[model samples]
Target: MRPKLVLFGDSITEASFSDGGWGASLAHLFARKADVILRGYSGYNTRWAVKILDKAMAGIGGDAESPAAVTVFFGANDASLPDQRCGFQHVPLEEYRENLRSIHAYFKKKWPSAAVIFIAPPPIDEEARIKYPSGQAERTNEAAGKFAKACIAVAKELSTPVIDTWSKMQEIPNWRKSTLSDGLHFTTLGNKVLFYQVVNILIDLGLSEEKLPADLPYFYEVDPNDPSKTFG
Candidate 1:
């Protein structure tokens, strides 16, 4: 069986395979290499996500031939303020950290051979969120940083690689304008940024462009006369 790449998180991850989403970009990049699994919980925080982690990983069949890579990108909802608007999704800082650690432990036990990456929560544009038609002042840049740091700590503790999207996005000029859409969601450009960031991290971890070979034979390798001859 082919190896897998799992993306576990919330809305950002659920919509990742959508148009111009980071997950979609990876799908194209890893076309035949591995099956990209999206385990996105639209409005879940780590607390809720962990409850369903077992189900999400059930198909992985932890073993030597299990998933090749996994990215646990969460924290957006965890950083939500403990107010009516986002209280349901709010996971306290300490619990969030513990949740991450628990997730790492679960994966480590399940797929020990798989390389794991953690993605810190990205920043939120408070002003933009409030202006959003269906949004409230739930997430904030400050909380994002806090959770991002917490995520980084978990990665460091687990000896895994992490992508600090929160700080990285800020480095760019007019980042608010160019990096995010709808205050909480990513813009086209931001999606590209995430795709490349993930690519770079995978490469650094010894996963190359050709690491996951095309699932099917190259077009040229197929015989035009007897297409069946090309079936692997």
Candidate 2:
């Protein structure tokens, strides 16, 4: 039987803008190799993600030996400031770290043998802050990077693997300009790039096989006025 992999995350993971966001692309890439379940929600933080995972595993009676692999991505909403536009508040770095530790402990207890991969959120476009005028975009960006580092540290403590999407994103000079049109969320190409990067990381960790397709499918475009088309 193929391994069951669960992707639990936020908007980026939820693919709020397009149909085949990175998670869908990952599912396709790992088709037949594993059963990939996309369990992501928009505007969720680590605190909520832990609850969601608890709800997901409520009735699944499998222990560590028969546990499922879980990949977690958060910190986007957690780093946001308290504003009506963003509809989320900033969580302190220490609080965020505690939440992450809780999540790590939860999965470790439920699925001791299952591999857990922590994925850090991508960098935000400082220029995009002009649209919403957060003024704290740079600070938020720094905090997000710190959150990723915290996750890596937690994973190290737990002996789990981590996929540093943040660092990988930083290496791309045009990532912000080309990947994000609004300084948040990814364009089609951006999601594709993330998909491949994630798949490669999973392969390197021996959690997944390297069977990615050469040419991945793009999201279908329709009316320009439709926000769903632009975001989902």
Candidate 3:
């Protein structure tokens, strides 16, 4: 049986397939090697996420060598300033730290030998993210960095891999305008960046052609007159 790859987090995760979608990129990369499962709960922070890990784990039962990877991406909402934009989801910094720790601990315990990777939330655009439609306002880059620090701490302690999206996005030119659609969500270009970043990581972690089953009969194996004859 093929192993599984799970993507877990909040809205960034829920919308992972939107536009060009990072999740879609992983799906194509894993192709026949694993099931890329999305377990994103829009607006959820690590506080809420820690509570839901068991439920998420229940959906996929895997031993050691299977389900090879799981990536945990979060923090945007938890870093929300208390006075601005959807404070309901904001978790205190200390709580956020512990929440992340709990999440990693649970994933490691539940899936004993599975490789767990963490993705720090990307920078937020305060200018474009003004409280719109209905909330207070703005998710600052400074705040997201703080949460990213917490995420990195968990990764270091557990020896898990982590992607510092918050910092990477900043390295790009005019990222606020080019990467995010609304200062919060990702644009298609941004998705490409994320796709490449994640796919490379998976590759480094052994998601190579050798590990995947042939997507289908290779073209060279095709019986032009009757390709079906070559299919299993």
Candidate 4:
């Protein structure tokens, strides 16, 4: 069986299979080489993720090799303003950090051989968020940055790789407009950026298509005149 690659996170991750989404891009890039599994929950925070981690991971890696890789992307909702409409999703900064640590620890305990990667929350655009239908002004770029830092710090302590989406996106010119669709969610361009970053890291971790063996015989090797030669 092909190895698995898991994506675990909140809303952004939930929508990652949409057309032109980063998760979909990863799935396509790893086709025939690995299985990309998504376990995203919309409007969830670290607090909630911790509650369901075991169940979410249940049945995975059973009687087979553990996932080759797993990406944990959360924090956007956790950074929500505690007094705002989305306050229910807010998690204290310190607790947020601890939650990340707990998550990494859990994964390592369950799948010590799996390569775990954390994805820091992307920068938020307050204006765009205000313009969004919810218009609750629930999050701010500054808060997101703080959460991102906490995420990176956790990754450092755990000695795991991380994709600093917050800083990376901001480095791009006009990222607010070009990368985000409603300040928080990614636009197609944003997806493209994340896709490349993810692919690059996976390559570095030796999970690239070139490095992984395809699951079945290559099409070219199949003899049309005598199918059993390759099959049998």
Candidate 1, which segments miss by more than 4 Å at Cα? Answer: 131-136, 220-232
Which regions of candidate 4 fall more than 4 Å away from where they truly are? 131-136, 223-228
**Off by more than 4 A, model 3:** 64-66, 132-136, 209-211, 223-232
- Better by TM-score, candidate 4 or 3: 4
Candidate 2, residues 171-197, lDDT tens digits: the string is: 776878877656767777677777777
- The C-alpha RMSD of each candidate to the native structure, in angstroms, is 2.7, 10.6, 2.7, 2.0
Off by over 4 Å in 2: 16-20, 58-61, 64-68, 82-87, 132-139, 210-232
Best by lDDT: 4
| Candidate 4: tens digits of C-alpha lDDT, residues 98-175 | 999988888888888888999999999998777455666789999999999999999988889999999999988899
Q: lDDT score, residue 76, model 4? A: 99
Cα lDDT of model 1 by residue, 77-128, tens digit: 9998887477788999999999999888878888888888899998888888
**lDDT, model 2, position 61:** 43
TM-score for candidate 4? 0.94
lDDT of each: 0.85, 0.70, 0.81, 0.91
